[model samples]
Target: MARMRWSTSHTRPYTLRQRRRGRERIQALEQQVAELRAQLATQWVQAQPTPGTRLDTLLTLCSALLVTHDLPAILQLVVQQAKALFVGASGVLLFLSDTTGQMLELRATSAGTLPPMRVYPGQSTAGRAFLAPRAMLMAGPELALALDEQQPAQYAELSNLLTHWPPVSALLAPLRLESQRLGSLVIYGGSRAQPFVPRDLPFVQALADMVAIAIVDVEERNRTTQLASQLTQTQTNYAEIQARLDTAQAQLLQSAKLAAVGELAASVAHEINNPLYAARNSLYVVEQDLAADAPERAFIAVAQAELGRIARIITRMRDFYRPTRTELEPTCLNEVLRATIELVHTHLRHGHVTIQHELDAQLPQIVAHADQLRQVFLNLMLNACDAMPTGGVLTIRSTNEPGDASAASIVAIQISDTGSGIDPEHLPHIFEPFYTTKAQGTGLGLAISAHIINQHGGCIAVASTLGQGSTFTIHLPFTPPPTVVLSMYSTLS
Candidate 1:
């Protein structure tokens, strides 16, 4: 025998072969273990909450969404429900962006102490998901490493959130509505929290979808509220316009009645003039023929006086029925107003009424028929005196006022009286022919005044308080109608 000394070399082959076999077995065992681990992970993912269960929870959340009209409350509830679903998540953060997507904003977060943070689409996990509009996840050291890789200057503010609550894992999903990503939702799991598996992603995504729907619902509701308010305002404005139109139509009808009355008065005045002249001549002859000492002379003188009064009344009727002349010229309204005041001074004195002038020194001249304007002012002053009866103050003011876009400017004339104001029920009819409240009034003064103002391309408005006083405002544009100017020029030529 070669003895034990030869044994080291002689058994080396067997030892090497045995060692190689053992190493092969070990590698095969490791491969089987990795395959088994993969299979187990797949089964664990499949073992997550059933579709029916997810559907039930989703339905419950949707019911809550339907009743909850508040947007912030809905978002809070969504995050809270996501925390509950994961069972061990530390908190959730919601990042929303405007329609333009220029800037991302931190909207809501379930974690009380988590500092707010925002990132652009190319930066962090939240941003990446927003770009892809897909779900993403990171666990433990991997999340920390990714965050650290970001530039120190740009991500300095973001470091505090990670330092304060270093999550063991995080899951994120984009909140999308029909291919448009509105924002992203992030769920953070603490060190002791359960890992959020793949199956849980669907549930999280569903929550995100619910959030999208809620956002749209709230926006649409707000829009509807605004539209309703606008519609109500429009309806109110339409009612006001309709009321004004009705008033204008009534005025037009009254004007037609006045026109007819004027025609009748003109015909009647023509018929009465001849008879009045013959009667006046007969009275004069009778008075002349009577004896100087005869008692019949006094009777004849009284008859002549009565005839003269009748003739004066006929002359007034003729003036009232005369057609208005269309000739207009630029005339100073103050001069016309003063002339009118002088004519009515006697009547004002009898009524104990005082006149006050507030004429604007810089008041520009306006295109007008001076004679017609003077007549209009005379009628207004006489009417004011009648209204006072016991006496009061009359104020006349003039000023320049801005006009509409198409007009250059306007001259505003205001006549105010401190007297017993017209009754509200009677005010509207005051400008109608024969609608006077006075016992001896013909009721044609205001109607004729209104007609004259209208012919001048002006508008008149009256405001009265039953016991307080009354004010009549006249707005007249500075320029006259082209036809009036042309006709005047033609007549002059």
Candidate 2:
């Protein structure tokens, strides 16, 4: 075995002095190490987040980011905070360009004093991190040692650039979501100490996630609020229309009741007069044919005829009061309309209202009460006659709708009076009950007409412009009236 030689043999005379210096150096180093440990402890404590609150915060931040339209502002703030948090070398935030053909663009950088600002295409190491999006660490002998052995010139170049600002051994974390690279967050550790170690990878990753979620959440909230406001506005409009409808319906009811009364009055007059006239004629005939001594037939015949008239009057009265018993059958609208016109012929003749019928042959038969429908026509014809005090064209037309098969088979009777137009504002409420524009009119005729027609599954509408005359259109539902679903509320116009 070779004898071991100690180098201290030459310095023996100075041993005590060296020992004293060595002890002092040890004490100083120990103190410094203790101070450093305290600093590390503080940093560790600060790093701790609220208990189990990370996920909740991430969720809230994500929601906020979705509503933010200005991603650039969010990115700026993030980068600024990152600089302080990392306390590492200078950082660069690189963003992707919109154009697919172009390379990545560095939107901002902390290296404010570098060569006049320039954009870097997807080519350099920073670009590689952006493209690959993975955290990278190279320190100790591995870095310089690799640089020394691999490519000294390139290593020196990279070293110089990094030293310019961050001034350190470094760690680079790719800023990205999934595989899509938005940018990169580069941290600087001064030459004396690296900013991060392998232990800190999780924190870097967590920070990156928070930034991504925050950006997405802000944008979404803004969009949701805008949509909600638009929906609210739409609902408001619908509500206004509903209010108008409520008022219109009340008017319809009043008009319908008046019209029914008017028809009843007219029917009663006709019924009563017919009997009175027939009985008088029967008496005259009996007087001329029977002998005074042999038969005395005038008194008997006149009395019998009067009784018949009384019976007829009572029947008509019953019909007028018991309107609910109107017979429902498949009635052709054309027949009912013709009958109504004939019944009101004298009235129209008196008013000088010319009747025009343009009944479409295509309309199918409707299921309705014939007499009720006849009354509806009578009311309309009479109104038209009244409108044209000096004679005007009253056109009635019927047509079938091609679509709406269930209701398509339609009969439209339009009673247009060239006398005078109604106000536009009143047109929409014409179907409402108790509303009338005529004098000496109960206002119920039109409303009742609308109600009766609607009960038969039809609709009545009026269109008029002041000074342009008015046209009342009746569209009878092609389908038979379904069994009325009885309830506390009555179905009316």
C-alpha lDDT score of every prediction, in listed order: 0.75, 0.60
RMSD of each: 12.9, 16.9
Q: Write the per-residue lDDT of candidate 1 for residues 319-400, one digit (tens) a residue.
A: 4544333456789998888878887888898889999989887888998878667767888778777778899998999898
Q: Write down the TM-score of every candidate.
A: 0.53, 0.48
RMSD of 1: 12.9
Give the winner by lDDT.
Answer: 1
Q: Which segments of model 2 are wrong by more than 4 Å?
A: 1-69, 76-323, 361-364, 402-408, 484-493
Question: Against the true structure, candidate 1 has what lDDT?
Answer: 0.75
Task: State the lDDT of candidate 2 residue by residue for 60-128, as single tens digits.
Answer: 544555555576666655555555455454554434433462455545444432222222433444444
| Backbone Cα, N, C clashes tallied per candidate | 0, 41
